[model samples]
Target: MVKIKISSLSFNYDSIQALKNVSVEFREGEMVGIIGPNGAGKTTLLKCIAKLLKPHKGVIYLNGRELWSISNKELAKILAHSLFEVPKGFNLTVLDFLLTSRYPYSKGLWETEEDLAVVEEALTMVNAKHLVERKMEELSDGELQRIIMAKLIAHQAKILLVDEPTVHLDLKYQLEVLSILRRISKTKNILTVMTMHDLRLASIFSDKLVLLHEGKIIAIGKPQDVLTEENIAKTYGVKVKILKHPKAGLIVIPLSTL
Candidate 1:
């Protein structure tokens, strides 16, 4: 079944259109990556799916129901978002922060043993069990990113929307984060959608790639099918070569300017 169906979607900020006629469907347990250069509608499309920004036209459905009809509480059950920044005054430890994800179903701002068990499982998923007691501020960029992801795991949302999850992470952490997401999609049957700038990385880990440019979807399909030289050149205004890497399998090299 389709976990998310975005049809004829269009969005605008005043007269400036951010997205135009974008349509796509995400199935359960699929890892779909959105990639494009800066100023492209990658983030806009993600925000639209997360229901953080409403589209001016078209519709978004979650499990065949209108997204708008789903209450916030209900939405929380099916969808969870991981933004780039940590909220201020969040002085909680890694464990404490991760447990907050279960708040939607818990009571009195406290987590029960079941909640703790869930949090522990999330930590183990990211191999973050050792850092559970560390302060959020004390961890490195990569460690903190994993902790946040662990929170989403604890939330247990079927659909996950992440925005530039590896923006501040190092190369190793970048791969680790994406690898974790891919594993989650397979093992947990969660539909994962993320906006990524690392084209090669996205192509390698994602089952499907959606390329957006100039407020529209330029291409969408398997990474091998969608990340073509022609499509890359047209969308980014730069010529690129698509090659099979010896190790990574898919590699994108920007050859020249258009």
Candidate 2:
């Protein structure tokens, strides 16, 4: 299984410290959610893992190699990140847009049969086959999210880092997107790490949850263990009830401000 080990990772954006002495581990076939309030360094941690931001101290290892030792092209083949935004300036049809991500294997501007087949498979996996003909700019928020995911799938990366997958989406779309990520993580044996703001959804969908507050991990483990009422109150500054659901597993209910 693919393994990611982070140790004593610290980061600073000029004068403001974004992360501090953080550490965690992620394994393949598990969907881990990083949940926290604003300014909790959730995005910074992801950037550090993706090597988009250089940490000031400590190290991160993927498998056995240091994260910084991997070249950009090599990293792209193993790790891919998806942001909660649409592709700007593309304006192309969804099918054509997704084809742009296959440049790693195609190695040329021209499309090959392999590229076509892979893009088609990605479109099918993300359930966006019907939207292939639609323009990237014309899709709804939910549809755009699916297309973003399809681009990652087409990348054929083993590690997926997604930022705020459910932002700006309605309840139905939120559930749909998270379910898709969970399914693909287990079926494809990819290590999926996503940052989420919705505690209840994260608790239900994630196999593991890492709770961060002020750039440090408050708790990390199974959702039922890490998402306790005390941890929720400590990190979020809100009182909540840890409720057991017969169908949805554990759910969090916000009670009042502490």
Candidate 3:
């Protein structure tokens, strides 16, 4: 089902245009990676969808309803955004952090038994149940990411917008994080859209890819169709060789700058 439809979206920051006439459609059970150089408006597009930023022009529809028309509390139930940075010096336990996602639906300051059950389920879904008692400050980058995913699951949001999910991670963690995201997208039937800088990882895991350039969408489609050398060069000004991966099926290797 079409979970999101962005039509002619445009945004500006003071005198600077951040996103320009961009349009895209996302469906349930799909993971889409947004790729672009800095200033290409990838994050701006997500912020618009999350309603954190109002567009200068255009419309965003969530599950056939206008996004802006929905109340924040109602919208919170349908959409969630996972950020890149892990909070520093946070004293909350992993379970506590995940439980916060339920605040929108909470009746009071105390969490009911049902809320605890939801938190446990979300933790298990992200394979972070064992970390429930761990302090947020003690977890590694990867463990923190898993906790973030758990929070999203607890939110029970049908659509997820993640920005730079793999930032500051080693190769192994990057792979693990993307793999987890792909699984979550399918298993939970969530429409997951993330901004990523690693083109190779995006190609390997995303069901579809969106390439942005100069605040506009240069391409959007399946990985095979959108990750072409020509498109990469045009959007990133970098030359790359598209190679066949035995497992990944297709991999993009950067060759040189244009």
Candidate 4:
């Protein structure tokens, strides 16, 4: 099985430090959510793993090999990141956008039948085939979100790094998107690490949770273990009541600000 092992990872933006000696491990078929307040280095952590941002001091191993030693082209084959924001005024169709996900595998300037097949398969996997011909400017928020998720799946990477897969959507769409991501992690046996702002949703969907506070990991383990009342209080500065829902699993209700 594919695995990610990070040790002593540190990153900085000149004077400002983003991550501080953060170490964590993730495994295949597990959906891990990184939850913290703003400026907690959630996105920075993903960027470092994707090699979009270089870590100042750290060692990241992907499937037993050093990540920095891996070529960018080879890394693209194993890792895919989805920063799911609806692009405005982009004159592109869903099919056109999804096809771009095959750039790493494309040999020619044009797409092959295999590429088209993969695109179609990805759309189907995300239940977005009806949106294939729709323009990017014309999709509803939920539809556009689905298209973005399809684009990520089209990459066919083993590690899926999603930055806030559910954002600016209604309750229905949020659950829908999260459910799709959770299902894909198991079905594809890919390691999914997403940064989520919703603590309740993170607690319910994630097999493991990495709770970050001020660029450092305060807790990392199973959702039940990491999302304790004390952890929430200490990190978020909020007094919360964690409820065990009969249907929805863990429910973290913020009772008051500390």
Candidate 5:
């Protein structure tokens, strides 16, 4: 079934248009990745779906009902999201951070045993149970990434809207984080939609790809269909050679002078 449906969406930042007539639908259990160049409205698209930014003209439906009809608390239960870090001042532990996810269900009261159990499972799911008491600020980049992911799992939402899950991580952590997300989506049967700047990584891990250009969806399909030479060249303004990798199946190589 279609869990998200966006139709005729448009958004602007004052005079700057961000999204234009964009429409897409996400079915249940889909692991989708959004890819685009710097100003392709990729982040805006995610924000719109996450209800952070309201479009001037469009309809966003969640499970067939208009998205705006759902209250924030209810939406929090249905959709769990995480973006690149913003300003921070919290001193929550890894477990504390993860347990916060249960607030939508518990309303800031003392957590029940069920909440603690879910938090424990979430910690183990991300392989961070050992760091349950670790201070969030003391973690390495990769460790912090996993902690955030564990927190999301604690949320227990069926749909995850994540932005740049591998931001500011080294190559090893990048692969590690993406691999964990891939595994979680499969094992938990949740639909995940994340935005990534690395098209190669996105193509490798994503079950579906949404290619955006100039605030519109230029292509949307399987990685093989959306990551074509022609489409990449037009959307990214780069000369790319698309070939089947001996091991990676499909890979893109840029052949342009910087």
Candidate 6:
């Protein structure tokens, strides 16, 4: 059930190393959160996985096939990437925007009934069915995030790579989006990987956390193991109070700097 296996992955921006010899594996139906401070290679890792960035060293295997070896058309059928910001100046309607995800499997210039059905289902999954007729330019940030997620769902990719999915959302929508992602991961058996700065939300929603520091993985495990006080202090230079919430389970409270 291992969906992605990255070994000794390394990437650089000219002389500056963005990701160093990092190795990780993600499995089906698992929602993984990648967390780190600025300049920690979190975004780099996601880009590598999405095949948007070619690593200078190391290899990435998606479902046992070398990621770089897969053609872009074929890769698009199995992998999807969502960015933190919505695209600008697009005049497409919400439904039309979502239908674009089907292009990998599409033929001619028309969408079949099946494609339309999948888009509708995806919209419902993100609780944005009411926004179907709305223009993408008119939707709020939170609403647009949901629509983007719906497009990913509609793509029906077995693996989803998202960067800072909750970045622009308010607290409520942040949780709502994560909840939708968690449900999609389970229901569709998609391997969901997201970069998040909100440690508490990551801890609560993720089945596993990958903590990166200075381009290397400091820890990878369940939230309790990866978000330890010692790890936080060392990786983030912060002192934190870890408390248990009666309803929400573990809560991370940043107390002060190291």
Candidate closest to the true structure, highest lDDT = 6
Using Cα atoms with residue i matched to residue i, what is each candidate's TM-score against the true structure?
A: 0.94, 0.95, 0.93, 0.95, 0.93, 0.95
Candidate 4 lDDT by residue in tens digits, 120-179: 988898788999998888988899888888888889899999988888889999998998
Q: How well is each residue in 36-152 modelled by candidate 2, as lDDT tens digits?
A: 999999999999999999999999999989999999988878898985345767777888778877876777669999988988898898888999899888899999999988888
lDDT of each: 0.87, 0.89, 0.87, 0.90, 0.86, 0.91
Per-model root-mean-square deviation over C-alphas:
1.7, 1.6, 1.8, 1.5, 1.9, 1.5
Whichever of 1 and 5 has more lDDT, that candidate is 1
Better of 3 and 6 by lDDT: 6
lDDT of 2 at 228: 88
Which stretch of 10 consecutive residues in model 1 shows the poorest summed lDDT? Answer: 83-92
* Clashes per candidate, residues 3 or more apart or on different chains: 0, 0, 0, 0, 0, 0
lDDT (10s digit) by residue, model 1, range 11-83 = 9989888899999999998989999889888888888888899899999988889999989988888899886
| RMSD, candidate 2, Å | 1.6
Clashes of 4: 0
Write down the worst ten-residue block by lDDT for model 2. Answer: 83-92
What is the C-alpha lDDT profile of model 3 across 1-258, one tens digit per residue?
548989999999999999999999999999999999998998989899999999989999988899999999988888899863447677767876777899888998899999999998888877788999998888988898888878887888888999888988898878877877888788889899999988888888888999999899999898889988899899889899999786865778889998
Please give me the total number of clashing residue pairs in predicted model 2.
0
Overall local distance difference test of candidate 6: 0.91
